[model samples]
Target: MRLLVAFTCLLAGCLAQKPQPCASPALMTGAFTVTTQNEKLEMYCKYEYDALGQRMRVKQQGTYQTKPFTRDYLLLFREGAMYQIFDTNRTCIKSALKDKFHPMEIPKDATLQGQVVLGSPSAPGQGLLVNTWTGDMPDKKGKYLSTVTEFGCIPINNSYQSDEYGWVVVNLYDNVNGIVDPGQLNPPDFCRDTVMKTDEEPKNFLSLFHNLP
Candidate 1:
């Protein structure tokens, strides 16, 4: 089955952070799977952050084991713009959102939740910090959008969209702490050409990463 990658189109400034939130600029590589009575779909992803605590790059690739077709795409966020690279056809699209960072933006009136849970006792004073919130956003047309999100303090469990994917759960198996290879954040030569809307481009690819997911 074709996986429907869904996420919020973030277009706002930074949401206020609670004290001692999870560390960032780390690498989170994992899979998002959705299963229902009638269909099942899965996608693998690698998310990277820059030293400045920003989501600098993300690459997602996957396909059904029995299918011949595959989907692969990379998104680079920097310089106040978002760059997309479609792996199948080596096409690039650019969107200048003028926002440097794209973490999910929580509404001003969103409900807040968090706690300081202790970690391993051996590591004294070390504890797990968690922040979860939910809120609603009305689009320009006045359509209300609802979202739920969770963030980890240690960056171990990290963060994921609780509401973006219906019946989908994001499980991250590998968490790498270090600087990401510069090459991974750069657009390849094939994608350096002018942007063009071709018939082969995936419609949701750009829409998903338009904000900070």
Candidate 2:
């Protein structure tokens, strides 16, 4: 009888454990709101990825330093270039993209914090099941907490804090698979005449927002 009881207890413990980490869809488009210490940015973003080539294009229209502005970013990792388009003046600045291609997935080392429902769980078809995970950033520069859909592993929100950059929270939504328009990744015609600014120091995606005017 004790052996049977022990076996049942072991089975129950295994069943209660969360599944392994899952990666989000490779090609997706989504809208996200990012808030930092003094800036709030709302952006519609498109991401395309493969082993060799990856690109992220973001259309940002928000307030920075209490000033309203609209801008677009094309970060081509494989090409090693980042293009910043100023929508207000139709000007463009090109710089070397310093960040590597990072997939939109929870890290394997992340700890599963637990599961939660976004809405009333008692109401049928009204609640979304999500899993929360936390871990140190790959670079170990900060720590992050993220939530994603339990079924599809779609990211819902993430918050990160670091002494150098302060705190940043991003809420992602309206995510769907596949690229809406392949042409959107291409640099605008107006940007063709704009020369690449190689003299200034290269900045990653997050730091680019910090230095924005």
Candidate 3:
């Protein structure tokens, strides 16, 4: 009888329903480190996101080609403009924004790998419950794995790999629920004299890093 009961409990656990899909907060501020194998590049960036308004801003500092550089990007999807500011040269370039706003949430089509505790589960209030999800990228050109907190849907880290870009990983931390400053969404003052690059085709945020000199 005891053996039968144990087997039944195990089966029930295995058949438990998966968690529902959850979206991240509409507004947020966070810092993330990005590394790419193809470019051999690493960057630390602070970002502000406004999902509801379809806007985002990122300030990144990193070394590329053995040269230290600081760049800021303001992507305004609603306005259909993207501003790229090079702090090292005090120059700004504007281009048409082509990427759609992507919220910081696990894709609904992603397969759940499993759930695990990030810290010691035995200690109360010390462990974080997180879920891992994997899926094909939207373009179907790559595969991605993402880890996020189960309770609040906060992103922890994400990794993507493809034949084109090799592997790119982003580790997110110091995230807060709402925008720290609305002003961060605006283009920097240095961009006042920016000129639109009419001949250059628009590229997404990640593509910009891959093309960095």
Candidate 4:
């Protein structure tokens, strides 16, 4: 009787599939590079997480060029603050983060559109594509700051990842996963002698990558 009951329980467990957790930062650790279709706009980024799986540090560096103009910069984020080091002006700017940023996750109420294979069609891994219409994410001030009308996400290996947003399409490659040195997150002392920016500066470095008319 014991063997029969155990076998029945195992069969029932296999029949009922449990819902997987959304793309929580707990699953993401280590380093990744943010790259675009054009190599000239490639950006290197590294992510460091604490014991609780919350992001503790981030280091990003890249060179942005548009024809005759080019600018190189290094960005570091940690302890609820961001530091930007510009190579052209030899200046370091600091900005404080008002709220903690949680990576986008697929909502429980999302509508499943379909499933698609990432990378190539013959790839062994597949992703579930979902769309959230009523879900609108506001900026820090509770004001609707983004023009992104459609919110789409693909959950692969139980993680919400997307390759395209608005008019930008890029690939995220994470090949490094290990301990990050503490010194990498620190700004040089020379930056202190240079110009300093207040916390009210622009929030993102989007303007560095492109030239808007």
Among these predicted structures, which one has the highest TM-score? Answer: 3
Q: lDDT for model 2, on a 0 to 1 scale?
A: 0.74
Candidate 1 local lDDT, residue 196? 41
lDDT of 2 by residue, 46-133 (tens): 3433323488888776776667767678888887788988867888889977888788899999998888778845444666778889
| Candidate RMSDs in order | 12.5, 6.3, 5.5, 9.0
lDDT for 30 (candidate 1): 34
Error of 1 at 185 (Å): 1.5
lDDT winner between 1 and 3, please give it.
Answer: 3
Which residue runs of candidate 1 sit more than 4 Å off their true CA positions? 1-39, 51-55, 63-70, 76-101, 104-110, 116-129, 137-167, 176-178, 198-213
lDDT on C-alpha atoms for all candidate structures: 0.41, 0.74, 0.82, 0.39
For model 1, state the Cα shift of residue 103 in Å.
2.6
TM-scores for all candidates?
0.48, 0.81, 0.85, 0.45
Which is better, 2 or 4, measured by lDDT?
A: 2
Residue-level lDDT of model 3, residues 78-164, one tens digit each, is 877898877677778899877887888887789988887788454445567778899999889889999988779999999998565
Top-scoring candidate (lDDT) = 3
User: What TM-score should be assigned to candidate 4?
Assistant: 0.45
Counting clashing residue pairs in each candidate, in order, gives 2, 0, 0, 0
Clashing pairs in 2: none
| Candidate 2 least-lDDT 10 residues | 43-52
Tell me the tens digit of each residue's lDDT in model 4 across 1-213.
676666556444533543332443333335444444444444555545442433345555554443233233333333444555565565676655344545535445543443322233222222222222222233322111111111122212222222231223333344233334644435557564544345364444343334421
